[model samples]
Target chain A: MSAKEITVALVGNPNTGKSTLFNALTGLRQKVGNYPGVTVARKSGRCDCGDGLIVELVDLPGLYSLAAASPDEQVVTDVLLGSLEGSQQPDAIVVVLDATNLLRNLFLASQLAELNLPLALVLNQADVAHEHGLKIDTQLLSQRLGGVPVVLTSAWKGEGIASVRRAIAEVLNKKTKLARLTWPAQVESGLETIVRAVQADTGRAPSMADAQRILFSSDAHTSNRLGWKLSQRETVVRQARDQVRAAGFNPLAAEPLIHYAHLRKVLDGVTSGGAGKQGNAAALDRVLLHRVMGPILFTGIMLGLFASVFWLAKFPMQWIQSGVDFLKSVAAPALAGTPMLQSLVTDGIIAGVGAFLAFLPQILILFLFVGILEDSGYMARAAFIMDRLFSWCGLNGKSFVPLLSGFACAIPGLLSTRTIEDPKARLATAFAVPFMSCSARFPIYALMCAAFIGPLYGPGWESVVMVGMHCVGLIFAVPTAFVLTRFILKVKPQPFVLELPRYQMPKPRDVLWRMWQNAAEFISKAGTVIFAITIIIWALCYFPRDAQMAEKIRAAEPALSTHELQARTQAAMIEQSWMGRFGKAVQPVFDPCGFDWKITVGVLASFPAREVIVSTLGVTYSIGKGAEADSQHLRQAMQEAKWLSGPRTGAPIFSLAAVLALMVFFALCSQCGPTIATLAQETGGWKWAAASFFYMTILAWIMAVVVYQTVIRIL
Target chain B: MDWLIIGAIVGSAAGWLIARAIKGFQARRKGGCAGGCGCADKIQPPKK
Candidate 1:
């Protein structure tokens, strides 16, 4: 292969603007994917070297060391070591170092130099470094590090970025000499002995790169995978440690690790700055991450997100509604002669699918807020604040991000758990993720809220109740996690060590691309599972309808107008349908929870997914009109619906107690199929998925029953 | 007009099938020992 197509791996610590640099260089020329053999995703991009050369840049996940305690760090090991199949070892390694915190950032660079690869060090965030008045003699630093080239880069302002590209190009073009670590005499001897032992034992020479990979893979599984059989590996590491201690180089004990101490000493000698002070950014962090005010600020942020989803989306939703209405009108006269054909064409396909599609604006709005928080670097801070609360539930603060993301869709949220270093914590986060109120639950909540809460309180209360319902799910979910962790599954908790990335403006192209990707996934879902279910539901309520009985009903209700008689006939027809019978059969089970046969029917149909509950009510109340087809009018109709027989006390059947019980059930239930699939994938087995489903279903049923019985007794 | 439904479904299915097929080809092109040798590809690594 030509030198111009050389692969370059980018390695750095988190919050170092590594992603910013990637976007700057690639500029819409990137592909997002998972690394082979792991669920952790790999983002790669191609950038031109201002020559005929194309630099294929692979961005490795952030890590403090090669000690592969997390799935993410393991990826760093895999790529740098060239163990991953189908990927050639990177021809050059670019270590992105944060200039503001050069001491700590340089530790990884020092480690990378030991591998003796073609290396280029990019001093990222140079603008921040300069503002703090830090002056570094780059030539001296380079000479001390065996002449590795260094480029000062400010990724955000697009400053000195061209220098980084040129540095990588120079390294690939073989114009730059390779860099190697000038380890202390003792440490160097220890590594050389270990390398020889590995080669002798395995009957093959250990590549210097392979030696680095083994040292980083300290986790139990990775240690086994790398075939660490020499038993002498540990002895060699201890010997190296003894040498470092013997040097009388007692740096800060545990406060700064030994590698960091060495790095800090080297860095400070070559660089100088006045005591760094806050440059206005600290003021923002004070309010955003403050103990007393952070939660309140976060609440305001969430309120804005929810309000935008409901209010700002109104215009586009109406536009889509009118578009569907136009399709209906156009189809009506064209298929007049065949009533069955007309209903199937307009109602089954368009109306059923259209109702679900109308929620696209709402989903897009949700993504907009998510993108904003992510771009601002506030997401990491939010996760940090949540750590204290998570610790109480035997989970680390990192668990909060996955659960918060679950609100959008559980699949991607669950996929994100790879970032959590602890296996037990990752699994716990995955198990509790489905309990967070997802967008799928919005349809159910909107229907019930309109029917019960909206009219009972003001419109403002809709937002309040929506937020309150989410809070209820969140509050209950953690305790449930605590109980699960303590009694059902127990494991040691991992330490909370998170990197709060610096604040930078999110790239608009990335945000828009993410929004489009999410929208496409939602549309794909609507076409497959949602579309099939809608058709099945229409078939369920429509088949076995009687023309003879409809005529008889029309004759008997002669006083009623045509529209009224037609509506009554449809209701009569549905009451005699198979679905109505099935609802009645399951009525006894739900009687304790105060659900009538009609509500029971809705619940049964909602098994495929919870959002169908609204559409089910739409069809049941509309009689044979197939409630799943109408989205907007369904809520109003549900509010105006009455039980066949009035309450025993002559009150309306859908009492406040019944409404509360239903809400509790929805809050506790795991009713989404995609969530089940996601759980299965994350858990690596169906056992956890099945267990999650059964437990949540049983819990919801019990809570609903207790709520109804307690309320009935008090009344 | 109803054929639009047919067309859309066909188009989406074909697109999905093509995507899936491409993924399969890519996986095979790499040529691994087992089904899961592609695990590393699915992982999101840090961008350089």
Candidate 2:
């Protein structure tokens, strides 16, 4: 390939603005995907090198070092070591170092410099560095690295893109004059001996960087890339480690000391004036990380986030609800001639599906606040404050991110456990994640709360109840995690370590983009999973249509009051229907929990997903005597729902006690099919998923029974 | 006329839903997060 088409890889630590620099260099010119055979995101962009030249720039995942501990770090190692399939070794490397945190950023740079490849350095976030009173001497710093080209750029503000491009273009074809980082004399000699033998055995030249990676990594991919036998590699590495230790300095610990010592020399006097920013940061951290105030502030922020989901979304939610009602009204008139058809169209299609879609606004609003916290770097602080609470459960603070993500959707939340590092803690997080009240549960909570709580207690109390219902899962997470970690998994927990990023102003475009993406995903899932469930439920209730029941009601219409006749006829029609019979069969089991046969049927039908409960209820009531396709009508029917004939005859079924029981059931229920599938996939076996499903369902049932019996006795 | 419109609506909706389910199943089989999971393109294949 021509030098213009040479592939250059961009590497950096997390939050170093490497991605922002990549975007600045290759605006509107990137293709995003996963690396072959692994799930790590691979982002490649075509960058124009300012003259008839263009280079393909691939931005690899952020990392702290070359060590491959997690799958994400594995991809970075594969790419740098040329072990990844379907990808050529990068012809050039550009390391983006955060100028504000040069001391740490230089650690990765120093590691990469050992590789014999063409390389350039971009001191990104230079403006931020200047604002913090750190002035970098670029020429001196570059000269220290044997005259490698260095460019100062502020990628966030669109400054110095051209200079970075030029620097990369200059080194696109030339090989770096690679220097081996000096270790203790004995360890250095041992590395040389291993490198020579590896070259002699495979007849492939090996750099000291190659030897270091092979020794540190036990991943098969790394071994395969180095062309070393796994057993032989393991034995040789152990031997070398022992030899280096015997020579005086600790073997494994000596390399970092040597690299950092050299970096200290090179970076000397290259930057100055950090005391002001450090003092400012320390002052802020004192309050934000306060023992007394930190937890309270975290709780307040969480309360604000959840509150916005209900408050800011109210107008848009109402607009959506009105549209659903309109659809039902139009369809009702259009299908008036066919009662069965009319019921199915209005009740099944419109009301059932409409209720789920109406909550789309709240989902987007939830993600908006989340995106702000994440992008502004406050998310780490949230976890930091929650560490004390998590530690008691044998999990550390790192597990909190996954738990928080469960609010959006349990699938993604469960998937994010990869960052927890400790397998025991990660699995424990997965086990407890389902209790975190995912967005799917929000539809059930929202519809139920607004229909009952909003009217009786008003919106203020409605929001409080909504947020409280959401927290039910969070309230139980600690105990659930403790049980799984101590008794179930029987594993010890690892210490947690997290780096808090410097807080910065969040970019609006990024936040809006994230919101739009989340909305699209929610909308897409609604059309398939939610829509399919609505149709199935609508069909179930519409079937075994009893025309005779209607005729009997008409015959008694003159003798009986209209409301009584309508109620009796509707009750008779449902009793003979398939679902009503099924509900009756299941009713005895649910008696203690305050649910009658009809509610039991709704619960059973919603097994595929939790959000289906709203739609199922919509379908059920629409088929009953007081069938109304709108929200107000359904709420009215629920309020009037009564036992047909018993000691509790003529008593409303959905009483205050019953409603609370049902809320408790759903708050703790493992009802979503997607969560089951995801948990199974995440835990790598059906055992944990089955266990999670079992415990949550049993817990939900027991909680509902407790709530109902206690409330009944008090009343 | 009502039958024709109803038939068309049911047929098309079923077709669309089936097509989407098939597409989603295929995506899941390709070794990543399921489509309903927000992390479909981002998460690794099923872990051990």
Residue-level error in angstroms, candidate 1, position A518: 3.6
In CAPRI terms, where does candidate 1 land? incorrect
Best by DockQ: 2
Evaluate residue A114 in candidate 2 and report its C-alpha lDDT on the 0 to 100 scale.
73
- lDDT tens digits, residue span A299-382, model 2: 677767766777888899889878888888788888889876787678777777776788899889987888888777677777
Q: Candidate 2 — which residues are off by over 4 angstroms?
A: A1-7, A19-57, A85-88, A158-171, A174-184, A197-207, A214-239, A246-248, A337-341, A554-558, A562-575, A625-637, A645-647, B1-19, B41-48
Which pairs clash inside model 2? none
Whole-model lDDT, model 1:
0.67
| Tens digits of lDDT, candidate 1, A327-388 | 87788678877666666656655666666777788778777778777767787777777776
Output the number of the lDDT-best candidate: 2
Quote the lDDT for A714 in model 1. Answer: 92
